[model samples]
Target: MTDATDMAAVRVDAPGTSATARLLAEAARAVDAPDLVLAVSRGGVRTVHTGGSAAPGPVPRELLTYELGSASKPYAGLLLARLVAQGRVRYEDRAADLLAPGLPVHPAVRRITLRHLLTHTSGLPGLPADFYPQAVPRWSTGPYGGYPADRVVRAFLRARPRRRPGTRWRYSNFAVSVLGHTLAAATGTPWEVLLHQQVLAPLGLDATRVRPGPDGTDAVGRRRDGTPVPALDTGGFTAAGAVRATPLDLLTFLEAHVGGPEPRDPALNAALTEVTRPLLRRGLRHAHTHTLTWFQHPSPYGRVLFHAGATLGQQAFLGFRPDSGLAVAATATRRVHRGDTFVATAYGLLTETP
Candidate 1:
């Protein structure tokens, strides 16, 4: 949906935003990138800032999109929640039940479920061992760009888990990739179509797109050596991580997560609630639990839900306090020594007062 909120308008130093704007500016300068965008919403107020760019243009607009990388998991998780809410699929349903016929797999693969994949307890490794060899050669475009989905399933079938399913928490791009394929097969819809219909369209995220097209307006992913890299093409693995969106669009998504102004779609709201609900506890520094795809941390002010995503040359982060109504989304064009500093700064600003 097109918003009347002008993309080129100047952002004012409104109450609750001055401090964040200051911090965001610092993050933009600290990161080693040609350009970056920072957007945030707190207590119903919104702010946007852009820094550093190679394009002979003004600061990046809030509507200019960036690769979200693993941040796409939340979108995949939300789609699962919507299907479950529709009674079309169940969290406990075995993943193996949804695959195409003739696919081979170990018996343990039959026991994995949507819940297991969503919570990162499916026992699947972070990736197939062969993933790197296949991906590194084309790191400029996308490691897995145009990768075959059937091969992913075949590799998954032959692989054994490090531990029993649900016995421990392990982040697996493979698990989510499988989940996305299974969901698409079950619904008889492409993963991208399902996400756009169920989530983006209803929320009016017109600027957000999967496998971002070759539009010159989108931010370029720059290598450490300053060479330009193509945007990620997840191919059949779009569900695992391949969302491209603008800071404005991302803030709109985060707004929904933190109960900011949003559309009156009840199903989307219910699914979002499910996505944010803590389903399992994951013991880690700062983080305490896992939601559908978000990591939940115990903060002195309240529960903080967070997630970070990175591709070959891009990094993205989202964090928010559901109780305090503070949310942040940041994106950088280049992955470099100072890349991490930008995200850490965003988080610090999100949780602390001015």
Candidate 2:
């Protein structure tokens, strides 16, 4: 059932912040979800819409939970900022110091800071050490199976970074995984609990979950060819890409970043601001940059920040326009491959929201 608040949103116009329902329908057809859920909001009012091959209306949120892949990074980033706001950790704190002394790591790796990891400038490899050789066997389904926490720690301790820390920008799943484990180490709290206490709980995203293994409730993903792709099992990289969420929860996440919705908490609001604040820039053109988590881009509507993620057979997009309080969250139950326009449509929706 549509909530009363969302039902009333039909009469409320936030101005300059929505594409007609037709565009949403078109986007749904292009992505071809079993059920595609979208939530768009501005000026505190929000509307939730669904498009897909499946029969629409109000499918229960439980069956629509989609794996959020790298899109989960923003939550990790938010957790880092929230911890900093709570005085539990600092951005400048070295990851080595947080994880442990004597990681058998090189001097440069030891010098890596939380900010470097958060912004993907830590110079660590994008995946865990020796990922392919082990993952190749399972690549078609779920590739992140063998690297458990112990193995992950062992790999980071033994492997070396190609570039010095903080010298350049390279997206590193390794660095963020280490950061997540490091946070767990530093706070004396488990990764799941800390994330829940810091980010998810405050924003009222009860349907959002951090999963390390399979979930029976979430929608099963499929490839373009219709082969089922198993959900990822991030044994050690729980912080890197283990998030799953219903469209409603994901929409609330975007709304929180826009400072919309109710049941807000003051510290979380501050941390939200900190996460979106541009920390540094990358790319030769300088047009593409990054904040703590999202990619920052210049758009005609204003500056826009977004992050898109793909599991083996699903694509997720989350973005918002802070200046206008326009936010969007979308999910497709198919993998993102070359020429896929799922992300582009979502970006277009953000900039062209009427």
Candidate 3:
């Protein structure tokens, strides 16, 4: 609603050297998005601003919040990790163990574990097959709006798994959403509330939210064609791809990934380390790997841990070099072709940085 330029910059840097300037400039060119918010940090020197926050103007202000899309996945995995650390749940805990009292759960669903869901090895499809036909007509506002938690659980129970659990990797929104429900069932706490109390609140990420609220800084997303894409109503599937947050809040989360202070809870700090460590190898080439939710790319600088996410209209990226304690994040208003150049460029700068 408000022009991005009018919002204050989240962090300011003294005029960085030409090298830093060139890297930022080069990243901006690569993205082809004038309104992209780009952030880079290393050893306490950092710059965070929108390259085109004012597009065609000099002033730059933090833009409104953008849905972090699948970038939110790691948080769900972290919640499970925290639960595990608290001895509340184990990675091998079965869905049936958590959610099978009165609910009808598929036999295969009963075998699925927290690890499988977090690592995308649950063999569940990206979405329930029946979701699309029923959802397309409501695409403008949000396809999943008002889908009840109980019905969503039932859909997973009826849906068939494509492969045996943990046999192979297959990305699934359904799996994580189910994981959220199971976590709630196991802990007697709603998934959203659990995350808020255990993760966001402790990390001081007060601005990150599962659903868009009346935050004055909220930024609406746009389709490739520049038509506004209303924020998604993830409904029961909030853990899958439903977090919307300011760039600053996301950067703080990424900071924890690269050894920033852990939450005040010592158990959570231990779990944070456990969650980021490589857990499973994707049955793919070049030794690519996945942690609980992050994709790990072997880089000379160190394992470049990263994840990029896309909603129908928004794209977000979060990455860091744990070895160097360097982290970077970028976001764009539109879900343009072939993912986003802003993401690519930001990552390029990170990987190429000394």
Candidate 4:
């Protein structure tokens, strides 16, 4: 059931982009998305492929936007690494140390460190355990919405670790959100401002919006049946997700992970290298491995580090295979369902790239 929009997304004669366009089109069909955007990078060069109409305007191929969910974690991770490289922070720094003095922390919470948070070994919940009450009410709308920075800090103080910090790996939005706050506390800057100063601006990603908005957005998330889905509000769990970006910017972000040819501050360069290295292992049979912020999977093309993100109305996947200098970014304006294949399809394209 191809349409003009889908075919139009895959035009030929773009110097190595058409192949990616073909793959992007396949991904678009697999997910039955109203709009899809993809970008591929090889040896630091990038190409973007976009399909359908995500919203009601003229979204130039270059600026199609999608919520980047957890795919934003690596950016947070990179910021940590950069600061550490610049001697502004240390990986072993305790969360308590960076957070406000006398913030009153649980003993277990006090034990969590920057490294633990970065590696997801801090034994924190995906949200404050108590957040379930709010979640149950707005389970479909915006569970993470009403909470704010102060509430997040209060939740961190009240948190009780199920397992010892660094003892086991558990993915936690609560941990990373606190990490972002801690970084802000340590640097004397707000989280969003600090992020822009250290990461987004440095990468020239003007199209990316990690804060509340860039306003006047171009894409609207749609269901497979074409119902428009509400945009997700991260509330206080921003560092865990809460990012929206164009495919081109996502590709540039991935290229940095693969040592792209760009002049960067020494700290930023150091961070780009650090986030991709193995940092921890856990789970049954030690079957899981993680970099500072990304989930690392073994692939024929070396480590395939990737993370998938889903907002209420969009899903995005970002990954890179350093051995192959291949990075792929794919997005669709549809809610992430249990069996969605958007992530898997994007991962395959990265691994399959030569």
lDDT of 2 by residue, 24-98 (tens): 655556665555666666665665566566544344532368889899999999999999988999999988877
| Higher-ranked by TM-score: 2 or 3 | 2
Could you give candidate 1's per-residue lDDT for residues 1-354 as a string of tens digits?
234244532263433467767766765666666777777777757777776656635434555678888888888888899889999899998777787455666767767888898788899988888788877877666678646788787776677776778888988888999898888888899888999888888777777888665556677777777787876778657787889887877877787887866654666778888888878775766246888889887767787888888887787888888888888888887774543576776676566643
Provide the lDDT at 11 for model 3.
Answer: 42
Q: Rate the local accuracy (lDDT) of all candidates.
A: 0.76, 0.77, 0.74, 0.77
lDDT of 4 by residue, 188-248 (tens): 9988888888988777666787754545554677765678766778888888887778777
Name the better of 3 and 4 by TM-score.
4
Who is ahead in lDDT, 2 or 3?
2
What's the alpha carbon RMSD for model 4? 4.9
Clashes of each: 2, 0, 1, 0
Displacement of the residue 182 alpha carbon in candidate 1, Å: 0.4
- Residue pairs clashing in model 1 are 34-52, 34-53
Model 4 pairs in collision:
none
List candidate 1 stretches off by more than 4 Å: 1-17, 53-59, 101-104, 284-287, 336-339
